[model samples]
Target: MRVKKDTSISLFYDMVELMERLRGKDGCPWDKEQNHVTLKPYLVEETYEVIDAIDSGIPDKLKEELADLFLQIIFHCQIAREKKEFDINDVMKLCLDKMMRRHPHVFGDSTASTSEEVVQQWEAIKKQEKGYEERKSAVDGLPKHLPALQKAQKVQKKAAKVGFDWKDINDVIAKVEEEMEEVKEAIAKKETKDMEEEIGDLLFSVVNLSRFLQFDTENILHKTIYKFVDRFKKIEKELASCGKDIEQCSIEELDALWNKVKMNARKNI
Candidate 1:
């Protein structure tokens, strides 16, 4: 029988059943051919689409993107079920059990008075659950493929929890400056590998500074890129107003136009 879309639970089961039908022998050849490896890209794509939708600040778009992401989860669960590994129910059960285990302050007798304490307790519990004694390092659990900025932040955070962080934000700032100087030295020596390594160190220090300041480095860079693109388009429009284009302008002329755009942007702000 077809499940009615009257409730969220029913809708979820409907999605699961739909995936099952799609992977059946008489169903989609493309869908049937897909395995966990083949679907990895789609999983990543849908997750980023959901992030983009949230960034767009559109409720309907976010809702649609969330559904798409959820579909990827259900599809993966269906594949696992086909292989007799696990299904959606098992997935949900494991997550629920883990949550209940992790949140001892909420679900058990443990007490966590502050959000910071709660976070610390959660990490402690997670480390214990993962057998901290057997792990080689605190950084062992970090995924290798995480984005560089995020990975740097995570590695720093993990180390910080174990008292490996700088005692002062000023120290982090000094490290950034030291890295910048090394980068300049590498450039003067014309060493490609040294320059690359110094640049990475500079960025890593900057990531630490951002975290110390309670900021997100990736989101900060994303906003900066958006601002640059927006201002560049305005520069293009202003140049066209004078019957000139960016390519037709001299370097000084282009710089003057860029200044005018920046002034206009500040005025609007």
Candidate 2:
């Protein structure tokens, strides 16, 4: 008996056509020339743009941004096909298989009564399927290429998973204070390397605190930076209204403008 395929054949064929058109001789030069390495920045940018669109709470923009991210996946698949490697179909199949294997509560006899139990089982199944050695720490699989803030969070979570974590939020808070003290000590010693290391430790401890408090450290930092940019832009506009550019403003004048913007922002909020 012939085995029946599980997905939409027409849609798969359409994706194939689209990929071929993009890589064809008459296709867009940039799309045809792009490879995995060249598309790395674009993949990262699209991911963040999607996140921003989601945070903006605009469904239309979120849809468009998600489409852009999907396009990157397709683009990468097209490049792989050109090299005679697996294509999009292989990717879909592998993902489906992995999901089915991981979700034994749904697909097999393994029992999971809560989301927490499901997560623990999923992690166990993932390790088993990946043939991860017993000696492999939970942090072993974290990608080094991740952004520093995200990497710090992932490292903290992995350590937490293995019980090598603070006892409570209070413990993390105390650790943060200790790390800050070390940072100050390094600053007082005037040792650049020590200061840098202490600063990193402080940031890492903060990431741990974020984890305990159920916050995404990366997202928190992003939101803080967005607020800063908005306030700084207000300051710039205020300066421009007075026929003064930022470069022409004295430090005192800028500080006053910044304070004004902060007060106005809080008032509006």
Name the best candidate (by lDDT): 1
lDDT of 1: 0.91
Q: Over the stretch 142-212, how does candidate 1's per-residue lDDT look in tens digits?
A: 87778889899988988988889999988999999999999999999999999999999999999999998
Which pairs clash in the backbone of model 1? none
In candidate 2, which residue ranges exceed 4 Å CA deviation?
Answer: 1-9
Position 145, candidate 2: lDDT = 86
Which residue runs of candidate 1 sit more than 4 Å off their true CA positions? Answer: 1-6, 130-134
TM-score of 2: 0.89
Q: What is the C-alpha lDDT profile of model 2 across 78-125, one tens digit per residue?
A: 899899998888999999998899899999999999999999998888
**Candidate that would win on TM-score:** 1
Residue 96 of model 2, lDDT score: 91
